[model samples]
Target: MLGKLFLLSLVCFFSLNFLSTINAETNLIADEIQSLKVTNKDPRMINFSVSLTEDHNYTSARLFYFLPNPSLNKSATRGDLNGIQSKFNNFYVDFDTNKGITGSRFIPTGVTFEYYWEFTDVNKNNYKTEMQQYLFLDGQYEWKLLTADNIFFYYYGNYNKNIQNCFLESVSVVKDGSDLLAIKVSYPINIIYYLSPSDSRYAKPTRSIVMDSMTVLGGVKYTSNVVHSYDQDCGVVKHEVTHILNEIAGHGTLLKLPFWVDEGFATYMMNKSDYYDNIIEKMINKNTVIRLSSMQGKPGTPEKVNLYYAQSYATTKYMIEQYGLEKYRSFFKILKEDFVIDEALQTVYGHDQDSLYLEWRQHKGLPIIKLVKIEQSSIPIPVATITPLNFPSKTTVNQQEVENNFSKQNNSNELAVSNFEIFINNYIFIIVGAILLLIMIKISIFLWKK
Candidate 1:
């Protein structure tokens, strides 16, 4: 009897200790933090206000961020979780000076950010806010913000006569596309652009990292730089603005997309059907055309990328012309609604993707793709897993209940992504960006020395 009683007491002790640890968030520690708030004051400054319990013991604070790509993984590029001392000032700690945090790399315009803050106390306890997001833009520069019924445009710079006289050029092209397709350009479209060689306040990484200027692609990031390409200036601008509309249609920038349809449709709308048409016949003849799915999650080399883009343009143009734009637009929306490519094709074209591919090949007078296996390059994409939960015996489980939960529980939200996994995807882009910036910085240093 005494042995059993002693064992019961031992178990009770450990259980109580475990419960204490689990319930600590609500514990009445006098040093507990009371309130935390943050706001983006401007392009260069962020304001924060924090309050703590009467017996607070403050330690330090830090921030982590990334450049917001306009693609599905909006801010895939990660940067240092740089720190800023909170040096107490009355009731708040505001980072508003040049000494705080300011630079083109850290605060580029038109790029969005995914960021979070962490605060640690003297007790070694860490407190953090849920990750928040924002897009940085050149709000300071606004020469004209125009609205043409539903289409819009924002331009800044001295090229008012050169760039703004035909501000409605892209609007006109898309309007033609709308009339042909029997679809509307969802209201309040922002066709933001500037025609200047010295337009520096653009999106990051690609903002300054212009590639092979001999063949300079005419877009600052996602918005076109009109001064670069006079011949196809409107085409470039229309292509990019169409991308913005597509992003909205795809239910924002975070959702995964089939890039073929996305870019292809954009190219068609921009009237760039023959962007890279010269390579298509040769590719089809040599059986080197990339499969449609290859465009997802990974980008290719510059040459190969152009080929893919051309193929995308060709396919989308064919669909729109042959099957009527109304059906094509419905098809695009279904794909946007998260339907698999195969299912989307089947629903729209009365056949699977493979059948659709064959039909497209037939239209092009090329042989049908047979049993050739396309090898997929492995990428470190995280997939969600679930562990079966065990509840108390009193809880009831049923067939329908179990079936409903299988999907929700194993979705991407619950993936086991480590810090390193998140960092790697962002780090590669950062390295490229850093290399470009460093090259310019080195040249500047050399000039200064001279």
Candidate 2:
């Protein structure tokens, strides 16, 4: 009887052990992520899925990702799939740009986003898929590509080499300006050309703002279709591009730049023939030029608008020529770092805006006049015509000042005439020579590359 009882106990113990082993094996049967597929549902979102085979007991799972937008983020982006749905035996998540899932603000187009999925099973097995990449775009418009080395110029509509070349030419000037300002650009220079005013995505806003052109994210958007003529495109093309470069050098922040500094800096970079130079000269002769200090914000009165732009340009030119670019660059960086214009000026030039204005005016040979301190947002509009103020009238133009102005203008006119005469005299030969020179240079470059 005792032996039989012992055998029964052994059988019971073995049965219990076997049951425990089966329970452990059942618990070990957790889901393994077989595959991951990512897709863009919209310009801003990434829809993804994970395939699981065998045991599908994933009690908890999530995705870890980041935009390798030229580079990966220092921290990985993660999303919990606890409440997210799974379909067709696959789990998914949408890393949204608008929703700040792909880091903070909206992820700009033409940038690649990278991500990966991380999932956990009931058995504590954490599965991670490989990183994936995606480019965000609206996919609604056709595009063209124009390249000059590293500069990428994208345009819509028919290809015009002249228009593209204008942009390429502007690119060199822009870089030169950046160098002058002691600014740096690490990324590739990317620009977009909008052939027509209505063709741009920001067309309505562009029109509403009364601007001939605008730029965003280093892309130049202009109105109407034409290869920019030399003198004509300065107001639109180089002006907008200068603004873009300033934004770029400052890392896309121009909040601290004063209204004149911003606009004037653009004009300075272009350094083309001024649109209002004649008008400005006339105003100066009439002693009607607006005080440089009055150019706060973008004043909109028709009469003073050109005057404001002129002062801005003159002030900027003064800074560039008289103050030296090194000091201007330091000031540019200070403003870029978000210091107020007055503080930046004081730090860099040892003076405030008023003092700078006074100096700039003196440099331009304008008579000293007391200027009212107008609130930035409350700039008084000049009525119908700009009235001359606080100066000797044309009849009172002292002989010395007139002689000085006349001598300067006469010398400039003579120099311009002499250069033009030479050009006209050798016109046909000059063109032929230029063409041959360009061809030779191109051949040399081709051979060097080979």
Candidate 3:
């Protein structure tokens, strides 16, 4: 009976030892799966592993991958105390017999992100990790990726490929009296230009125009597309930089000034000689001259648009010439303070709106027409009258009276007739005397000759 009891106890000891070995093996597998390794191929796929442990709080976890083309993808797996989440079916045992899993995510070409691993074991332990990578187009032109402290600036395309060379040629970042500003040629991005599909009207309308040249936007960078034609004259980087300064000085408000003023300021900073000439020519040609009032908002019509941009350039030039740079700088401050166009102008220039308009008009050689009224009820008229009288009753008149009347009438008629007769007689006498003188002279001459 003692031998039987000993054999039973030994069997129990062996069973307990076998169970402890299995538990130790499971714990060793869990402890070995401490970290995950991630690898990215050219097209972007993610592979990683998660260690399962007890005492973690979360039962499942997710991993996110960012693509370059504005999209993201995620993979999720369940957590296990001794086994990985069942969702990761491809999971297998590593060389050391730890849990291993691999999966892929299709993200946009340029997508980027920071990732944190979120999971809770039976013991409530959490984990997070950050990763970085960039997706580039597959072509002959390879881009040098740049990232500084989580901020990234991607350079692509021909110009972008030679960014360092271009930067050497055109860019300058200067520190001036506690201020920093970078002057650089900003190449255009075709994608950004086409990004605002809804605002196509404001974008380049024709392939021809798009081919002509790229334009600067938001005063921050220059933009161009592959189809742009006028590439050589894109040296307006300084002009845009000045606008950035002006915008900042104005507290990031354009103050609803006319487009002319806005552009004029930019052009003025670019150097106004050429712009001034153009504006003067336009003014002389009676092209649209933007009024301050008219330039208070976005230019709507084609005529106004031309005027807005041209006049903006012109007026900004005028301001520089008349007000000086210091005053021009102060004008922005005034605008920021008042936020009223007319009031700002008056405060800065010491002139009212109408007066300013008159000045601008005069400068442009435009005539101002004013309405006037006249009154016409103050003239006097001259008067004249004639009266008819009946002949006096002759029957009762005495003969002497009748004779006197007839004699007076006859005397008046005879006076008139005598002046006529005298004139005729004088005329006849003068002719007769002249004829007699001629006859006597002829007779005397003839007698002498004989």
Candidate 4:
């Protein structure tokens, strides 16, 4: 019987173990991912697709992607892939640039995005493809790359003499700017040049922002670290690249310098033409040139726009030429430390914005008008101390009351202790009497037996 019971126990153990193993087992299968492709329909749309070696139904399919640079977060942006029936059994999705995900957003053309695809099978097992990178480009033109140092120039259409000159000069401008600012170009600055002016319509749409009562467009600095240009001049490249270098060097948690300092420095570095030099002088004579402090944005009228740019150029030129590049470098460093523009100027040049403006005007042979400082009157605000009503206060007892309560608790405890002692004494007395009775009965039984 013992042997049969032991055998029965062994059989139950084996059966239970086998069932647990089956429950824990999983089916592992690898899907063959092949022919991954990204097709640019235009700047307005993109198509992404991938093919499978064996046609197997997946419960879910998705594409995950993100731009590594720019302000776009590093976290992946998810895009769902169309069903297997679409595009002849290929997993497919069309990304509309003007609608849905990409939209008319500030996502710059020519920037690269890293992407990968994920698929979940019927059993809920997930499979992910290896990561890949694709550059978003203008599909309207065949692009040719011209790379120098850390600058990547993407130009399209037949190379004209202007294009050649701009490309070569851009290389020199980028190198010189990087050296002058003492900033290492860790990431590539992509310059996408639409050779024909008509091609601008097909290129990525530049978003417009209203500034200073004017809709400002046509600026290449719309996207960070990327330039979309139609100009054939090397000055355009220099001007735009100076903005990029400035951002790379001095931008900290504070994203930008003042508009005048930023735009003026770019114009001065461009060395484009003598046109800006005379525009400011004419505006000064007409007493129409806006103050540098007030020209914090691009102005409304065309004439004011011209004056704004020229004044910025003139002021920045005065700063660098008068105080020297080292002082300007120090000023940039102070700005990087998140100092306000006026404070940075004061720290570096021992002057404020208005003072710099007057100094620049005096140097330009323009009238130096003393700006009236607006002192804001400090108004004392009346503060009300609100005391809440109807709330119960903590209950307080007198010293005599506390003593009386303590005495009562002591009396109760003494009564309980005395009752417990009396019960214990009675129990002992009863137990001793029973023992004596049992001893006498045992003696009587012994005597009778004897």
Candidate 5:
């Protein structure tokens, strides 16, 4: 009986010790942090405030935050709170969203951040408050959310047909794209659509032109599975969501997939309209279809932009139709393996860019224009070297004349590009002049009416 009593006492002693250890750890944070609050001061700033318990005195404090990316990983951002304030057992730190004390990367509005506060006591013991989530917004509008198929659409004002269509179409695109590409979208994608173009200050700002005193932003996708747009067009949603899928497929690869492949795939997924079809047909007739090598980047001029998208769509369409989507999928897989466009084409389609272009043209039943066989080099200079090749067409064209005409065409293209650059360089002056002209016209019309 005495032995049993001693064992019971021993058990009670260890249980008390264990309970005390847990209670001490739990109180460490609770005792230091009395209350915590985060406020979105405006579109450009956020204020963090924390009150500590009277028992503990702290000499140092820090705010740590995290921004999650699509790869299921997070980046940590820290701010020193020592100098900001520490009176009445309270601490305050104001973080500038634009400057992003974290780094040079810009953190746009509407992104959710997880943050916590850590305090160092005079005894050098560190205590951290519980993590909390804060949604960064402009705090100027009341927003509403609609969820469908892992997509969250946030908007303000009345729920109109346009928003409904955007929501439904975005859901369909996500489903179809995920199944087609075998990509599982495990996380929710947040899309913030501004109901009024006037409210664009709250949306992600881009380098955009102001036309007719309104901002035009089709759509933009960020690496964190966040999308921002001002329009409710279903086509724009399809295009942007396709880019999200493309990003998922190529995630973790060092080199980015070429612009042609990326944008072309997005365009193809959109299911082109009659206007796009007309553009492709017209470019084919002019024999000005941009070569694959020339399609390394996006075009500058509006006309070239139209031609670029049209031709890219046509090229991607031909590949999927002629060879089959499964083969195209294999090609995409190769591209994800860090192979360049030329090598990926060669491996999957058994041809290079030149041959693929030739075959696509043949598929279109267009007149065969012989492309100069330029020697491949480590660094591709835009200079095209001409080499004569036998043509399948029975009609003989003057080789010398063709070369000379090609040279003139290249020169004319360069001149047009240069002129466009000059126009773009004077963009600010042109905008100011156009605005002045509009104001003058308005005043004249008012006087005439009077």
Candidate 6:
């Protein structure tokens, strides 16, 4: 009976050990299944799902996932079967992941899933935005598997989300002859297109354009029709850009350049053609005849607006052509310092305001005047003559005086007749005869010893 009891005890011990082994195996399988994990990365906090497919031979696993919006996020979500199903149906992801299950034939070779979530607020009211993410698998004793396919799939989702959020407010395709063009501006700054008709004369506000139709001042991207019949040259846009930059760089604070100078600079930057060159030449020619001082600050008359624009453009062009950009820039700089426009020109060009006009006039072959003066106070007066002792006395009547007088008269007659040619010339005979008579009188008195 004791031997029988020992054999039964040995059988009981073996059965208990078998049961314990089976329980341990089951627990190990459970632990391996629990080790599988999935992750999603997105800029926007969106819900998504990931599914795993296993191979019976433990060779590889398939991951199926879906991304409804790939533009904003870069990740996938994993949860209970029902939650995963809900997200998967809404958002779709491509197969990515290749890992084999351990000890068991089941492996997650790929994932299939979906997501539903909102993206972060990208400040794209006036501009567009873009986004990306990474994913790693936490498996039991699987060396922490990571695959690019999975990560890339999430990136695609983020990309798609951004694409969906991106929307163009207005688009314009302008045709100029053989050229095809398109211009688009996004939301927020929609005022660019809604400029008042009056403003159109001055500037083009930020707005939308279509083919012959325009929607200005709308909250959404304002659009307008392309009016080819009324289309202006692209230079018009340049003019508008200048105004925008001027305002944005610090509006009224810019140096108060004269209207002509300001407008001329804008025109130069906008229109650079032979036509403009001709206009400048005309202005230069006109300026040579007219003083710049006379032109400065002169308001345009009703009929002279076109003339004013042309002349202003010419003057500014001349300045830029003669004085390089450095000096041109300096001109504006000085103007900014609150110098009067004329004063600024004088300071930079090394001439007074009026002188510049004169120089320009001269350069253009215009008439100029010069004056001369004579001084009369620099002449000297003649001196009086001295009388000699032997000179003849006209009132003397003595025999010696008479004889001297008679001899003087005869000598004077002889001396006067000496130059007969002088007598022949009427004027010369009068001058010579008088000189000879005075000499004869002196000689006669000396001969008489008086």
Best by lDDT: 5
The models' CA-based lDDT, in order, is 0.48, 0.48, 0.36, 0.59, 0.61, 0.31
Tell me the TM-score of each prediction against the true structure: 0.51, 0.52, 0.41, 0.70, 0.70, 0.31
lDDT of 3: 0.36
TM-score, prediction 3: 0.41
CA RMSD of each candidate after superposition: 19.9, 24.5, 52.3, 26.0, 23.6, 51.9
User: Judged by lDDT against the true structure, how good is candidate 5?
Assistant: 0.61
Question: What tens-digit string does per-residue lDDT give for candidate 4 at 1-450?
Answer: 565555555555555544543343232233566588889867766788877665556666666554454532232122233334354336876765533222233345676767777766666555667778999888777889988877788887787787777777777777887766676677677888776445755453432222211321232643445676654556666677777777666664634566677677777777754767777667778877667668644444333456667778888888888989889888888877767677788899999888888787777677557798634222322211110000011221000000001001121121212334434642664555555555655555555555
Off by over 4 Å in 1: 1-143, 150-152, 159-162, 173-187, 196-198, 201-203, 206-217, 220-232, 250-255, 274-288, 373-450
Cα lDDT of model 6 by residue, 1-450, tens digit: 554455455445555544443332111122222123334331112223322222111221222222211211222222111222222112222222211211211111122233222111122111101111223222211222112211111111122332221111011111110011111221111112211233222121221122103112111110110110001223433333332222222112323334455445545554555655665566555652233444434233322433554555666667777777667666656655656656677788886545654565565566775323222221222211100001112321000000001001111121212223323542554455455555654554554453
Name the lDDT of candidate 6: 0.31
lDDT of 3 at 64: 32
Error of 3 at 216 (Å): 11
Q: Which ranges in model 4 have alpha carbons more than 4 Å from their true place? A: 1-31, 70-89, 99-103, 206-219, 300-303, 374-450
Question: Model 2 over residues 298-347: C-alpha lDDT tens digits?
Answer: 45432354566666777777787787888888888877676666767889
Q: What is the lDDT of residue 42 in candidate 3?
A: 28
lDDT of 3 at 96: 13
The global Cα lDDT (0 to 1) of model 2 is: 0.48
Model 3 has a clash total of 32
Candidate 4 local accuracy as lDDT? Answer: 0.59
